[model samples]
Target: MSPTKTSVAELSGNGQLVYGCDYNPEQWDPAVWQEDVRLMKEAGVNLVAVNIFGWAELEPSPGTYSFERLDQVLDLLHANGIGANLGTGTSSTPAWLTTLHPEILPESAAGVRAWPGGRQAWCPSSPRYREYALRLVDEVARRYGTHPGVRLWHVSNELGCHNALCYCDVSAAAFRTWLTARYGTLDALNSAWGTAFWSQRYSAWEQILPPRITVSTNNPTQLLDFHRFSSDELLGYYQAEADVLGKHSSIPVTTNFMVAAHIRNQDYWAWAPHMDIIANDHYLDHRLEDPTVELAFAADATRGLAQGQPWLLMEHSTSAVNWQPRNIAKAPGQMLRNSLTHLARGADGLCFFQWRASVQGSEKFHSAMLPHAGTDSRVWREVKELGHILEKLAGVAGTTVKAEAALVFSWEAWWAYDQESHPSSDVRYMDQVHSLYKALWENGITVDIVAPGSDLSGYKLALVPGLYLVREQESAALADFVGSGGHAVVTYFSGIVDENDTVLTGGYPGAFRDLLGVRSEEFLPMPPGQLLPLDTGATAALWAEALRLEGAEAKASFIEGHLTGTPAVTRNRYGAGNAWYIGTVLDPQALRDVVAGAAAEAGVAVQVTAAGLEVIARSDAEHTYTFLINHSDDEHKYPAPGYELIAGEEVSTAVVIPAGTVRVVRSFSSAPPTTGRISGLKDDESD
Candidate 1:
């Protein structure tokens, strides 16, 4: 990826697909800055995020600012014809500020203060922290508000990635304030919290504290509200920072989101509206049972945040991440598969965690586009090759992901599932969500990971996987989906609680009992390694139920179990569509059959229809680009729709994508035009 020192003229991608990476020039010598941009240009890189953790460098002391190094970096990028995604440099609190005002530091659930060795050490609700952070942001915006290379503003890096839940006194005060606004009256708060139990009623706002380390289990509703209040406080921090940027800059503002599996704090569905462009940071945790499926799920979740619009892949690893247990490096061709997978799902901009691998710090072992092995490494070659492929994907920039099914993905439900008491400790929310998504993916169906209560009109099928908490309005929407001819499958442990974590009174699966045309009396959570056989030959594990069907017919009944002859899976004819219910967690293979059955009932066509072969299409009004990725070890033969973009071959016959490789074809045209860029600030909007 060595550059030829070409004085290339550039216009900031000029409608081409975005190729970017997080750049950390402060780690290297100033002399290397020249070669960094030169190589970036040679690799077809159009954007570089700068100064993400530059707080200490920018302001070495209070009221003293320095931007000499950042100036050189941005100038080099501008000279090399690359756009700059300028960071606010407030992601981490400087040691000086923390030392002066230690009250800004966050406290853990156990009341231990988080030290400064880690990033995001400040409390989200700390006023002193906000004062210092916003001051730095305002200075930086005033300095580079209209810089030609600046295309976007990167607000506080991966907000709440580390310190989302703080149990400090400041947070307690802020939580009380948020509660006052939410409940409006103390009596209403007491009633909603169900304080009649254990004499937990509140007399005044001052008596309330965060659900910290308690002698016994804290009230579930209190814990839920604390999670809710924490998310709102984090969002409030971003809004305040973004408002500062808006005061001085007109360029669109953005913050990288942690939309992956591990992070479950902020409700992105609520935060998506504040951004000009939604962006997300995803790192492969190959340690997961299935990382590939998780990748697609996260990407689709990000696109869902944008309402099916093309968004940015703000950060992902080139190969291995440093934080995982084994830190397994990706094999040959796997990088291409991972990058193109995100693009296929709807990421217009493809960027890694970093441009160059770090030589110092804790993340020095983390893989980057340019590894420590330099340009001679396979990662470097793949980075350049990915840049070239992105150039070919220029037509895909404005295209949006196409999906026929909507998987109800709710953050509130996730937060509620944090309860210490549940039917089975093994019945994880992610397990159900991932299994359903994996089933759909293995069968070549792409699903939009949408929040509950979203419009179900466009989707033919809806899958609710462990929606433990649903608002009354959300329950109505799912009912309306079935009434309006949309097929739905509700799994066990779903629809039991409302938004406040209050159990629905009538039956076990309270909210949807009538809609499901069934009633359950008790939970029959299975012991570890226990398996129950169904009459239809499918096996269920981890859960079972004691129930009786009211109107729905049994699709499969338990043949040999504690609840023998009971309806394990039931299908109810509800209005124009069918509503199916699974009373237990079926094995992955069995779950696939159930999901396929629902899809067939809804007439949703499976794409590749083969295991390990993922086919998803991103289409515009003019044409569609189909991405065919072979994650399996064997080659695949797929009928070509049009010319293969990556290979640059006219595929009149079937295209053979070898093991661990990916291919894209310009498929069906005239779906819909999804081409629109967020307009920049007006002239008067500039600093």
Candidate 2:
């Protein structure tokens, strides 16, 4: 079901906002389960995800099953007025299954088999593994399908999170079957892959193999197709399980998406439409230059995946995560700030990775809603406080976020751009994406992170950064967006190739040469630290394109470099609207200037741009709900005329947001509701 049909209210299953956490009862004694329920009710937790990794516990033997403990857990939750987000328990295979069928174990590119001690140790394409998993799913759904305690049916937990790519013979055969369906014949497959090079043309379907352990560099097109196949293969597996659940239940089903900065194996655009309610798992990656900024970016990106519907925060840490080299605990109020940031975007449900901290395991140190320090800890107090706050803001459910601007993103482009051969090693795809996104983010210009080829008619401006792969429809959609009077800002390295990994031969940036009104013959990637001076008082580094403008006029030129007097930036009056082309990497200040100028020309206005103050709004036809977050050490005040939801007070001029705190207000202002999704975009748009 789409978000339009299944709103956040429907997802709540109890007419209240969802405050949830992943609960592992099998890890504890039955005595602890009762106490956990008491704490959950006190914390306003209405939903709990259970049996995520309960395969071994559910079915200990081949045909024998155990339901006593699960039945008890579900009954306990139902009696407490809490709904269960029931997992199919197919996340990881059990040692019993793997020991009987070792052939089902996944193999690495080097042909090393994955061991059973770890999760997701089976190959995705193994038929025997699928058979055994589906049997469990059928039994679980039959028993709990009509149970009043069930809120949503959760598919396998975080599909393709750990073992996305498998190089076993089972996967190889599956890949061959997938290719035949895609290309029909070996001749067509060879042509699409450009296998004519290096005398690698295939004459038979049996000659093909996955791009694994190549002598030198593997075929780029083959590698790209393998990635596409891998994502599809996993989606097929998810659909198979979802089909079984659909047969036995009326409940909606979903799997948590790994849309964080560090996870890229699965392309969520291909997975979004399949979800009943898009849920995401995000852990703050300290390795990022700025983890907090990336956290906000991830939330917006997940909203984009849901087309702006209310999603669930499936798993987030209370403080420090178990992973990462240097795990640092969060500050006094950082947890509150982080949780509210997600809520400010589009999350209707706030949940953590766990209910209680594990005492032993690989993730023993992972932060949970109830930490190992017990109820005396600060984490537990804040967890309860957040639950109370959620209860107060029940009216915010089913409301949609509004944005007049969009940032175009593509997972296919990321896969291709991250390939071994590129202009420069330092020129990463997300770097450009972050640079543009941060500029819009800091300026308070709310943006919907959209996939390519979407309907741009609803947006005033579209920001395209480093989308290296452009299919026929995607290319035409961008052209139509600009021709139909929508402003566009396109960065370099975008539109360089087609879906088949074929370089457009007429000129560089083959896919969008005419739309950009510029032609490039070659890419001039600079040294790691080399900087080229520009006429606009900005320095360029990492990448510069050797180009010639046919109709576009130069906005900035390289003042000193090998390509002196060449165009660094160009502007084209394509149609009723304008398209700005960036041919080289620009500094943060320069990039922000370009983005700001384009936003201004497009008539996009912001509510606030104060430093350390972030403002986001969700609305219906009658009222607007504004979330004000203060990330700085000092307090800040902003004009917001409405009733404060948390404090139940009315405000006239401004609301004072305390340092490291958040405030949500139900404004008296009236705004139009969304059309396609609460994401505020059109319905006809797709990836």
Candidate 3:
């Protein structure tokens, strides 16, 4: 049966704030429902995510069911006029199920079968597991199908906690089935995995084995297939729950996703076609102040999953989280500031990691709306204030934001890097992608984090950093994108392998050599503290690709290294556009120069010129909203002239915003023109 349509176009009837946080009333007494509703209303919360982990409470026995407490909670929320995001509560199964069916237990990478203790302990490939979970979901839907408070449906929470691998017999059988469907025969599978090298030729599907602890070699092709198998296994689990929910409920359904999570590839794109709305959690290390780069990257990634449709910011920290080394509370306005930043990017809704602080558990110290000290705390006050503001700015919800540039981020490359038996251990995939993201954000370029196969037709420029794995089809797509007048900037060590992590037999950069216009014979790994001076009078560090020019022209060269005078950067002109190759990791200045040059060639507009300041714009057909935030610890000046949205005043002079402050500016103008140069405007200018 076709899945139910739960897309934004269908569910977002009104552009209002869909306010709520994950609620675990099962942990509290049902008698406290009245006070909980009052507190929620006081905080302007209209939506509550319920039953996220209540499987044990709902179904204590295999057939026995209890809905007395759940019904009361639902009735209370409905009476208080708060909407509900109903969860299937299958994230954590009951102890009885695991005891009765031990086969439902998951197997770890070490081939050790995990006992049922924490959540996500069930084997996704087990028929008994799917049968019970599907039945529970069906029961919930049949009971709450027409509930007035139910506004949305949420499936299994954070679905792949076991990292999607299973070495159990059931999973091994399922893997054979999946391989048969994918390759149709053992010969095709053997050839695809390059099994000839290890003398591991498969005679039949039954001979095939999952990549468990028994496999220890550094075979990229084997590891890649295993990762793919894991992702597909988890997808089946998500689909199983979704299929049942779709059959009975008209409400939209979604599960929270992690940003740039390497375990899942463009698999989310296929899963996106099933979800009505996409939601994800955002958590960064405390050492990083401006997670704007990561947040924007996530917003774009999730939006790409739904084909540029807006997504929900399902979980973010209201203040300090206990998981980090130091649980530092957000200084006064930082929580509200970050929430607006999500909205400024592409988020339609804002919700925290939790509603109430856990009294006891691993997450006991995590930040929440109601702290352990009750409603009289600073965190509580800040939450209430932000909730009030969201109620006021409900009109800004569902507005579309326009981006001029896009970044090509692929999870295939992520897997390829992890599988690389490389000479250097310091090279990381996420770090490189983050570097490019930071550069774009620092330059005030609105970037869309895209998958390998996304359409680059709408974007003027696309930046792909550390593209180690470029599948044959994706290579063709990139060529087509550039061939049709789109500028692309690709870095070194890219296009070296295929989707299965098998290296292409040709010279380095494999399928992308012609498009990038350079051939590399060897990768020169520089010693620590060594620097390669560029012809642009800039220095680069770490590794450099020794290149043989093909159809490209050199833009920059190394001056002092053994490969001196060799091209450090090259440009190749395609049909109507150009592809630039960066051969080494450069200093910030060198990277800025190279990226700026490409941006200029593409004619992509910069949104702001101020350093340490972020500019984001969201608009509808009639109005435009701009957010200018100062993330630095000291005061900063905003040079661009514009009218302030919140204050309703036109700025003829520079405005000085103190550290960690933000200003909202709304314009009636169709587009806010921007200059690319970094302004030398001082923070004390308003004095």
Q: What digit string (tens of lDDT, one per residue) describes model 3 on residues 378-445?
A: 88898888777665556566566676677887665777785545846566777677777777776767
- Model 2 residue runs over 4 Å out of place are 1-5, 606-608, 671-687
TM per candidate comes to: 0.95, 0.96, 0.93
What candidate 1 gets wrong by more than 4 Å, as runs, is 1-12, 668-687
Task: Write the candidate numbers in order of decreasing TM-score.
Answer: 2, 1, 3
Indicate the residue-level lDDT of 466 in model 3.
87
Q: RMSD, each candidate, Å?
A: 7.8, 4.9, 2.8
Error of 1 at 681 (Å): 51
lDDT of 2 at 72: 98
Report residue 342 deviation for candidate 2 (angstroms): 1.2
